[model samples]
Target chain A: MSETLQYIGLGIMSVLNGPELFSIFGIGVPVAIVMLMGGLLTGIAVGATPGLAGPMAMAISLPLLISAFGFTPDALLPVFAFLIGIMKGATLGGAVPAILFNLPGTPDAMMTTLDGHPMAQNGQPKRALRIAQLSSVSGDTFSDIVLFVCAPFLAVIVERYLDLPEKTALLILSISFIAAVMGASVGKGLLSVSLGLIAAFIASGSDLSPRLTMGIPALREGFSLTAAVLGVLIVGEILSTLEELWRNKHALKVKDVENRGAIDGLQRGDIRRIVPYIGRGAVVGTMIGALPGVGSTLAATLSYTLARRRHRAITASEDPQFGTGVPEGIAATEAANSAVSGANLIPVLSLGIPGNAAAVFLILAADSIGGFNPGPAVFTFTENEINPQLVTAFGIFTLMALGNLLNWTVGGSFMRAMGVLAKIPAHYLLPVVLLVAMTAIYFQETSMFAIWTTLGFGVFGFFMRKMQVPVLPFVIAYILAGPIERSAREAFSASGADPWFLFKSPISVAFLVLSLAAPVFLSRGGKKPS
Target chain B: MRRINQNMALGAVIVALALFALFAWVPNDTVSGFVESKRGRLSIGDAMAPGIAFGLMALSGLILLLEARKGDMPGALEQRTFAFLLVALTACAVSFGVMIWAGPLAVAVFGGEGDTYRNLRDTAPWKHIGFVLGGTGLVTTLIALVEKRVTSNAVMIGLAAALALVGVFDLAFDNLLLPPNGDQ
Candidate 1:
């Protein structure tokens, strides 16, 4: 515990004494803090705009950040700080569009539009925004606190208990669970996972000769990770959105509302009324977020349902109900979704499994930046020497805390002013986004091959989405393939090439059994996690 | 009915691909077998992971096929999808062609007798030419295709975006180079 505290202190000091951005009165401001601020503002802008989200911004920024700060240990803190700030800021900013224009900027904000739009209609737009900001910050802070306490302990426990075979089994179980829970059916999900594994294995990283390059010279080098991922996630989304827009010729226009005796601020009574909803939202959001592949859309939905039930029971017949411009509805949804941003990191930090797209980007950033990697080893403490990864982990936690602090102080007003961003048509933005994404990929890989690969993957992704196949399982499987193979090989060698290595140990057997059973037990049809 | 047919077709395609991969592709493409013994130490080989993956795909494909017969419908692609893809890909190809060949063509036409695009690729005017032209064309073409009209506003926006990207990526960062230029 003392060692942990010492490491935390060291982590805080590292950020404090990080590469100076500027000096203020004989004191230096670290680049990490400034980047955090910049990322938060950008995240707000992106999230406020309909059809733009945190992951897309992070995807576009990752390569740029890498270019600015090379693959060095010193770059990790600032880059991570920026990404985390974006995650937190976007969580708050997603509520803006929902409240002002009745459009959910991000899918999780769908619940927000239920009450937020009505509140805007009732001339309590400012009140709704205030409620959203307060509850979001409160829930976000609660989840961060839980993460601060939980992630390190969980990592330590996982490190102590899991071995090579068990770890390999665990990765399989994670993939299976994700496949089962995501997409239309267990079969389709598994197919997506298989395709991802094939993509990852096409050019073998470990072997002297490439495995499945299929006689293509470029395949020997394998596809670039950033290109493939962004191709599917961002470029694919762009293509799909553009197709819809073109087919329907529908351009969305936001209608302005006249302020009718607008009440802006929340009272003491209002605060007291919403606190319970916020607490419930925080707890529910955290629990769901800790489970890989379950996202904040479910969290907000569940929390809003719970809040509605309780509110219905207590309120008089004449009182404003949950969805009829009530502050409580906004509070419940905003809190739950925002809480998810912090708690999503729990799985990533503890077990090296990403729970959502935002978490995936964070993991990608860590992987690209090269010095730090997330997993149980990240929390490992030694008696003799300092663990740099542990310090980086603490630095990430510090950034989260600072982000929550900024959200509490200024995020509300910034969000309220972002109503105009929601007015920008999505159709106009997507093509530009595609061009930028291609440019970003090209600049990083410095090859036209990467651009072509990205375009090819983009078309594939579009088809997959249209066919109702989930893309998340495939992406997660691709990321985990290398680690899974490494663990399997090590376990096989360690156990003298025992064919049934995964089933030999009780824990490994249990995990393998669970992997098989996951599809049967956990399959949820065709629901996209936001 | 259309959705069900789509699912069935998809399932069949998946099964065929998986079978080909397992039987023909894996064997032909991979130099190593599923397992190899090197110097009396047995180890898993390159084909093991892909073999298992393809096997999984096969199982999934069979399941999907059966499920489709049982009246499960996921979704179907519309004819508009192919049309959209055709147009989009055509635009991308033409724009990229201009991007790749524009600089060299310009150099051949207008440069000093012995000067080549390679020599001038990093220099001003030459470096910015391909990116600005290709990027603007791409963006403008996409917007025009979607909005169903070619507007000057779309062209200006695309041009501005291309120029701004150049300013930020090329001028601001000394290490970073724009596309095709980077390839050059």
Candidate 2:
């Protein structure tokens, strides 16, 4: 208890004395606040917009901030604050369209609409929105606290396994886990992952030259992550959307409704009704988040399905109805998704294996900056390089808590405000999305090649959608490929190219066994699909 | 189903081309030369013996296969449109390759048909030609002007400014760009 107090005191002092905090007063607190507000607003705008998630916005803004303001720690504070605000805001805001228009703002918000829209239809929009906000904020705060406590502990354990072979095995295990959890067809998932690995390999550096350039001078430096991601995710999604439009000329019409009002805060009855469901969802989401490849979406779906089943079983016994515009439905989804937000960071922070596309983007961004590394040694390596005054793992927790608190207090009002945005026409919205994507790609390297690559990837994305292939595995595979290949190469070199040596390390053997066993076990108890 | 099968075959061929580029054209010249040199050290009799054995085996197999099944070649018109598109695409690729030496505008003009530009309001041949030439010229000139005006130092400064912007957002807000790159 005393140690915890000391740590808390140190964290508080560090925040107070940090250069970032000092610079704010010099610039005037009002000006700093305004800048932070601007960042928050911008984050909300980007987050609520499809194809403009948190990472992309940061990528687009980071270079501009660096070039405009220099590398002062003070300048970064507001931006970071804004990103967190945006992440929290956008997630909640996503359900606005999902509830009112039947269109999800982001893919992750799909499950929210299931019961949320029904409540809205039943003239209880405010109630539904309130429950979602409360559950979401609660889950988010809970997870952030967990992250704050667990990161250092996990970091400590990770530091001891910083060798090449272990890293390689860990990466392999991560890939296997991801492939297993992503979709129903393991063969297709593995194929997609393998394709991503092959693509990354084609761009990796070799002693003679960067591989597979075909004497093209432009490609000599290899493909940039920004370019690859833009191509695969943004451009691809757009092309796929366009193809859908081509196939189905008519748009699906949804009923338009006005924002009713703020959520009358949850009643005691509501709390009692939702607590068990929220708890279950949070536990499931966190567990899913800890694993590689199994992201929040799967967690949300699994939790929702499980909640429905449990709700049914209980109601069947008691002669009660469940899942009909109930707060428990909202609780299940909000808790599940919000819990995933923190849990997903576990693998990335601990093992340097990003569990999802967004996590992959964050890891890539960290690598570009000077202070951090992704592997097991990050905690120790970063401890020395990072400014002691800026060491704010605790502060991060505080901010996350504050962010969620703000979300809970005013979440309903925020959702109502977001409804005003849903009126924008697709034509206008899509063009802005295209422009943002173009500017982001251009800023990454200021090369026309990246733009063309993005366009090409858009076409590829369209085809993949048509083929019913999941794109997530491909993204994870691409990010993991370089690290896995590099680590494997290093491990091979260390072992004098003896393949058996991969299993020689205890960590490697353990991870390999787990990787092999996961599929068999996960698939065993689940009912076979009809 | 037949059309889809043909498309898949075409995809296979395209894949083959890509693989050749990856494995053969992209390898280090020294590596290729070393492999060739080692192969050349082998005796002619050693190489010829294997070739003869493989050829005899193939001949025997082919004779037996001729007795088992036979098939006719595809009709020329069955995939005439697809064949034409493939040829056109191949020509476009060749033109892009040729433009590396001849320059972009020159190839765009000489390699293209007048019908390609026929949709333009400028009906006169010279006007159509002038549009292509003038547009290319203007772009090239503008690029040159920008290059001349912006010194290397200025470009470097611009890059530095961009980096600082990224640093500010990352450090202050904790919102990061992407993998292993941003604050976790």
Candidate 3:
């Protein structure tokens, strides 16, 4: 307890003592803080815009920051602070469009649109925004706190107990769980996952003589992660949206409302009522977030579904259904999604694996920058010693706290403003988004190859969406497949006369069985969510 | 005109792809200049792509075929839009192909620095970006205009977008190492 308190005190001291205030727009702020604010500002802007996403912003910023900072120890904190800020800011910012315009800015924000748009149409935009803001910040703080307290301990436990077979089985468990979580039919979900595994396999051979390059020079280089992701998620979204507009000729824009509240932020009574919902969402989100590969969409969807169920139970014949712009609906979705921003980093920091796409940028950046590979080794300590990486992790937690504070203060009004702005026509907005996507791709990879890759994936994504195959399963599977394969191979090599090496460990056996059964269970798990 | 059934069309494509992946890919690679030794005994790693692709194709094919087998009326609205999307996709791919592959050829025929191919490859974001933006924008605008889905000012909008994108990319990301357009 004393050691924990001492570390917290030292973490605060480290942040306070280092770095003088630097000029951002000529206003003096600490370099670290400014980067945080700058990234947060950029993320909110990107997240508010329907066609753009936070991952795109992170991908675009990473190379620029790497070049500017020039691979120094001092540079790491500022760059990471900026990234952490963006990750947090984007989650909350998605709610802006989801609420006012009924357009989900990101996939996870799909739940937000249910109640948020209705609330806006009903002239309670302010109330909805306030509920969203409160829930988001609270959930983020809760998850960050959990991450700060838990990651080191979790890393130690895993480092001690988990063998290669266990790790492989765990990954399989994650894949199965994620496949189950995705709403697509079992076959489609499995197909998406299998395709991702195929993509990973294509580029990941030790011999590296272009295994499945199909004789294309570029294919031999394999797909750039950023390009593939942005292409499928953002560029594909752009193409899809454009197709929608093409169908309509002029897709009607949601008319702008006041986008502010008559009453101030949440009332005391309202806060009291919402506290339990926020708590539930935060708990669910943190648990999911700490897991290796499952992501924010499930958290948000599950929480929203649970909230609706709870509401249905409370008022058996209630006039207001859950989707009728209820504050609880906004609270549940925002809290759950926001909580994911912090908790997703737990596995990334503790183990080497990034849990989701947002965290992938951090791994990508860290790998390129060199000198720091974030895994269990980063958490090791001896007698009378402190782990430097642990200290940095604590510092990161402090940075996130500041981000949360910024979100509460300036983020609320900024979100309100975007609520009004999000109603702008897609035709005007999407062209610029496409341009930005291209520029980001080019600047990062410095190759037209990356741009073409993105465009290709965008078309592929369009088809995948049309076919009703869930994209998240594909993404999650892609990220984990290499690790799973590597671990399984290691286990195979390590086997001491055991042909069924994976089935040797009871934990592995149980998890593998679960891996096979989870999808079947999910398929049978009643269609009515919750 | 009888509307082509999208499900049936999709199912046929998937089945064809699955068959190609399962049967033809490995044999074709072996026939080509690839190592006959490696091709003769394919590893699990090597087979993963074809195996998975074929499986995915089969699953998608089955789903789409099932949908088609169950007699259903086509949503008149969706068929034309879906067809239009395919057209748009074709336009995009064609423009992209030209932008990347045909830039040097265009330079060779028209005008540019010496070693047109090398220059096109080296000055990727700056020189080649011009081809990409210009070609993609032109094709996209022309299609949109022809479909009457977009206004005639699409050309102007495309031009403005090109200027803005190139300018911002050049100015802000100096560290991006993009070669300056048109000879150094």
lDDT top scorer: 1
What level of docking quality does candidate 3 show? Answer: incorrect
Order by TM-score, highest first? 1, 3, 2
* lDDT, candidate 3, A335-414, per-residue tens: 99889888988877887666677787787666656656676666664337765565666677788888999998998888
Q: Best by DockQ, which number?
A: 1
lDDT of each: 0.87, 0.54, 0.69
**Looking at candidate 3, what is the lDDT of residue B1?**
20
True contacts kept of 2: 0.01
List pairs with backbone clashes in candidate 1. Answer: none
What residue pairs are clashing in model 3?
Answer: none
Supply every candidate's count of residue pairs whose N, Cα or C atoms clash at under 3 angstroms: 0, 46, 0
Q: Which ten residues in a row have the lowest lDDT in candidate 3 chain B?
A: B29-38
Better of 1 and 3 by TM-score: 1
Ranking of models by DockQ: 1, 3, 2
Q: List-wise, what DockQ does each model earn? A: 0.78, 0.04, 0.21
lDDT (10s digit) by residue, model 1, range A297-409:
98999999999999999999899898788989999998899888888888899889887888888989899988888988999897699999999999999899999989988
Candidate 2's displacement at residue A308, Å, is: 2.4
Q: Comparing 1 and 3 by lDDT, which wins?
A: 1
